[model samples]
Target: MVLFLKRMLLASLLFLLAGCGQTAAPALPTKEKAMKVQIEINASVPNKQPTKLTLQRQDLVHKLYTTISALPVVTDPNRPCTMELGPRYTLIFTEADEKTLIEAEAQRYGCRPVIIQGERQQRDTNPEFWKLLDQVLREAAPPATVQKLALLHNGQTALIDSAQQAQALYDALIKLPPVPEGDPHQPEKQSAYQITFFTAHGTLSGTIDKQYARLEGNEQARGGSYYVNDAFMQQVQDISKSAHYAPGRPDALTVTVSGPEISMRSFIDTQSEDAPIMQQLYTKITRLPQKAASCSTEEEKRQKKLTTTSLHFTQWGLPLLSVEIYEGEHCQQVLPGPGSEVQPDDEFWNLLHKLNR
Candidate 1:
C-alpha cells in the first residue's frame, strides 16, 4: 500500500496528474495471472543455508521487474564487483499455473548480478536491487517497512509525501540492479545523489553514483562510484520534475554555448516569432535521453577533457535547472549535475544548431 502524508497544492496536483494529461505509464501484467514469483537464497549474510521464497503481490513483482528492465544494458562480461560470493540468490517468474517465464540469479554481494539464467555476462542489477530484494525476502517472512522521504540533488528539495508516490518511487529504486565495477576499490569522492525513503517505522536512504552503484545511509549520505551509466536517475529525476512542474512550466529557458572553439552566448526566452521552434527545442532538451546519473564539477580535473554546451531552465529569471552537453566524439552526453550525465538524440543537437542559426 502507498504510505505517506499529503500536503501542499503541488502534492494535490501530483495526484490528479494520473489522469490530468500526464502520460500514462505502461501497464504491468495482471497480478493474479503473473504475480507469482519464486526466490531462492543461498548463503545470505549471517546464514549458511539456502532458502526458498515466493512473491505473489502483483505490485511488488511488477515494480521489481520494471525497475531492473530500465537499467542500462551492457555486452561486456567483466564488471566491477567486490567478489563476495557469500550471498547468492535466484528469482523465478512464473504464471498462475506454475509455468516458468524467466529465472534470475541475483547477487548483491559480489558482481551484484541479476543475470537471467544462462545469459551471457550482462547485468542491470546493483547492490540497491539486492538490498531491496533482501527487504522483500525479509518482508515475505513477516513485517518490514522507512523515514522522512525526499530526493536530495542538484540544489533542490522535493519531499515525497504522498503514500502512492513514495511507495512507487522506492519500489522503482530497489528494482535497479547493481553495476559491475573495475576496481570495486576505485572510490569516487562524491555520489551526487541521495534518495531517501519513508518506511512505516523510520528511514533508509541510498547514495547513488552515475553508474547506479549506491550505499545505504541515513540523511546526507555519500555513494560509491563504480561505472559510468545512468538513465535510471532520469526516472528518479523526472519523478521530482513531474511534481515540480505540476504548478507551472518554467517561464523561460536559456541555452548558452561555450566550448574550446566558440564564444559563450545565450538565447533567452521563447515567446517571439520563433516560439514554435523554441518550444520544440525546449521539449527536445527536457525529453533528452539521459546517460550518466550525474557528473561532478568538483572532479573536472580528473575527468576526460571535452567540448560542450550548456542549458539553464529558469522561472521568473531565476535558474531552476541547468545541464551541460558534450557534443564531441569522446563522450557525447548531457551532464545534469556533478557526476551525472545523459545522452541526447540527434534531434537534440540538430534542434540546438537550428535554433542557434
Candidate 2:
C-alpha cells in the first residue's frame, strides 16, 4: 500500500508539471481594428521639438495600443516627482476603446493623454467623409482633359504633357486627406513647390511641401488642409522629374536682360524648321538668373541705373520662353551690334551673337 501511494503521488506531480508547461491558446482576432493613429510628442529638447507622427498599419498600431495600455497608472495626487518636462506624448486613436485605456496608458508612460473626441474622432473612418472625398477626387479633372501639367516653384517652371504623367499626379492628389479644422499650432514652412495642372476644365493649382498640401478651393471646403505624408510627397516629386517635358519644336523664344546701365530684348523664331540656332538661344536664355539683385534702397537702385533686357523666343505667333534680365549693380551691359563697346564679354553676349547671326 505504501509503494502504491508513493507511485500515485509521483504520477500526480508529473501531470501537474505537464499542465504547467502547456502553451496558452492564441488570442482571437479583434473586431475593433485600428484604422489610424496620430502620436504628438512635445519635448523640451530642441532636437525633439513638438512633432506629430501618424501610423496607419493596423497590426503595428494594435501592438502600440496594447503595450501602452498595459502600463500601470500613476495615482499621485501631486505631480509625480519624476515629471520635469522631459517629454509629453499625446496619442489619438480612431477605434473604439475604453476611455480608461488612454488614461492608464498616459499615467503609465508619464505623459499627457488625449482622445480625439466628437466628429474629429470619426474623421478617418466615417463613411460620409470618405464618400465626399471620393467625389472630390473623381471631379478633379480626368487625365484626358489635361493639356499640360506644370510645377512652378523657385521662379522656375517645368511642363509636361504625358497623360500617364498627369494620372500619377492626380493619383497622389486624390490620396490626400481633407485638411483638419483649426490652424495647427506648429509653424508652417513655405510651400516647396506649386503644382498647376492646366486642363480643359480649368487650371487646378495647389501649394505643397513634403508634409502639407493646400489645394486652391479645398481650403474652404468641408475638409481643411490636405495632409500628405513624406513618402507620398517624395513619390510625387519623383514622378514629376520622370515626366519632365521633352524639348521639341518650341513655339517662340524671348530673352530680356536689364542692368544698371543697359536693358536689351532679343526675340528668336523657333517655328522655322531650319532655325537650329533658335534652340541654342532658348537654352542659353532660360539658363539666366531668375531674380534681380537685392538693392537696399530705392535711391541706391536708381543711382545704379539698372538696365532691363527682355528676350522672346517664338515659333510662329506663340512664344516658347520669355526671359527677363535685371543687371546686377556691379555688372555692365554689352550690346551685340557693331561699334558696341563690349567690356564684360560673358556667355550672354556669345549666345546673343549666335542668335544675331
Candidate 3:
C-alpha cells in the first residue's frame, strides 16, 4: 500500500509539471493587423502662446446638417472660399472637402474643429463643444504645431511624466522654429530639443528645440535652448533612408516601415532598469491600438493591414513595445514567412538606444 501511494504521488507530480510546461505567455497581436500613420503641419499664428484645439463633431458637418436643421444657410459647393473674421464674417470653402474644410476653418477660427460624421437635429449649443471652443479661444492661438509626427518606424509613443507635461510640451511646440525645410543637418533653424520614441511597429521623433521656440508668437521664448544633437539628427536621416521611408510635402509626416511583422509591444515595456516610471507607461499605452485605429480602416485594395503603437525614450535610452495586430493577405509585407509569428528581438532595441544617445 505504501509503494502504491508513493507511485500515485509521483504520477500527480508528473502531470503538474506537464501542465506548467504547456503554459504560454499571454498572446500579443501581430504587426499585420496594425496600420501606422503620422500627421505634420506648418503654421504661422498671431499668438505666440500654445493653443489647445479639439476636434468638434458638430461643426465639421455643418454644410450637410445645417441645411437640414435650418441653422446656417448652405451655399453653392463649387464656389470659391471667402474667409472673413467676426461674428458675421463668414468662412467659406470653395473646393475644400470635409477634412480640408474642417482643418482650414479651425485654423481660421482659432478653435478645435472636429469632423463629425452625422447631422444634428437641434440648435442648442453643445456644452462640451462650447467648452472646448471657449478653452481654445481663451488660450494661445499659435499656429503650426505638429498634428502628428509619425516615426518612419511605426507604432511608437513617448511618455511624458504627466498629462500636464504633455500639455506643456504641446503648448510650447508652436513657438519653436519650423523643422528645417531641408535636410535635418542643413535646416535654416535647428531644434531646441529632439527625442525619438521607439516601439515594436516603428518610432516617433519629437523636437522642442530653441530655434523653434523663438517664433514671433511665443512670449515665453528662450534664448538658449538645447535641440537634438548632430549624431541624433544624422541618425534620423539614416533611418529615413531605409526602404520603408515614405516622403511627404509640407504638412505630412514621412512614415517608414522597417521590418515585417513588426511589434508595437515595445512601447509598453516599462521594465527598464533605468526608469521605473516607464513601467507605469505600459498601463497607459493600452489606448494605443484604439488610437491607431481612429484614423484608419481596412484599405480596400491593400493585401494586408496592421495596427501598431510604439514609444521611444532618449532620456532612458530605451524603447518599449505597446501593441500590434496583423490582418489580411499581404500582411506578410512585414512578416518573416508564411506562418511565422511576431516576436520581440533585442537587435532593434539596441539600435534605438544607440541612435537616441
Report the Cα lDDT for residue 115, model 2: 24
lDDT, model 2, position 91:
59
The total number of steric clashes, by the backbone 3 Å criterion, in model 1 comes to 25
Better of 2 and 3 by TM-score: 2
Error of 3 at 277 (Å): 17
**lDDT leader:** 1
Number of clashing pairs per prediction, in order: 25, 37, 61
In angstroms, give how far residue 189 of model 2 lies from its true place. 8.0
Q: Which stretches of candidate 1 lie over 4 Å from their true place?
A: 1-33, 44-47, 142-357
Report the lDDT tens digits of candidate 3 across residue range 1-357.
999999999999878755432221222233222221111222354543332323223343332223212222122223333454322111222222232321122222322222212322112223444433332222223232223232312323233333333333444443333332232544334343344333332333444332232222221111222244454444444433432333211111111232235432223222434243343333333322221122222562253344332233223232223223233343311222223234333443343333223
> Local error of candidate 1 at 122, Å?
2.2
Per-residue alpha-carbon lDDT of model 2 for 1-357, expressed as tens digits? 999999999999877755543222223234255555555546556774455455555665665555433322222324433454544445565654532223111211233331222211111112332333233322332223445566654545566677667656665665677555454644255467667655554555666776677554321111125777877788777866665444434555665555554455554454554367666655655555433333333443578665555555433222244544334456544332222323333766666556434
TM-scores of the models, in the order given: 0.31, 0.33, 0.21
Candidate 3: minimum summed lDDT over ten consecutive residues — where? Answer: 247-256
Q: Over the full model, what C-alpha lDDT does candidate 1 score relative to the true structure?
A: 0.56
lDDT pick, better of 1 and 3: 1
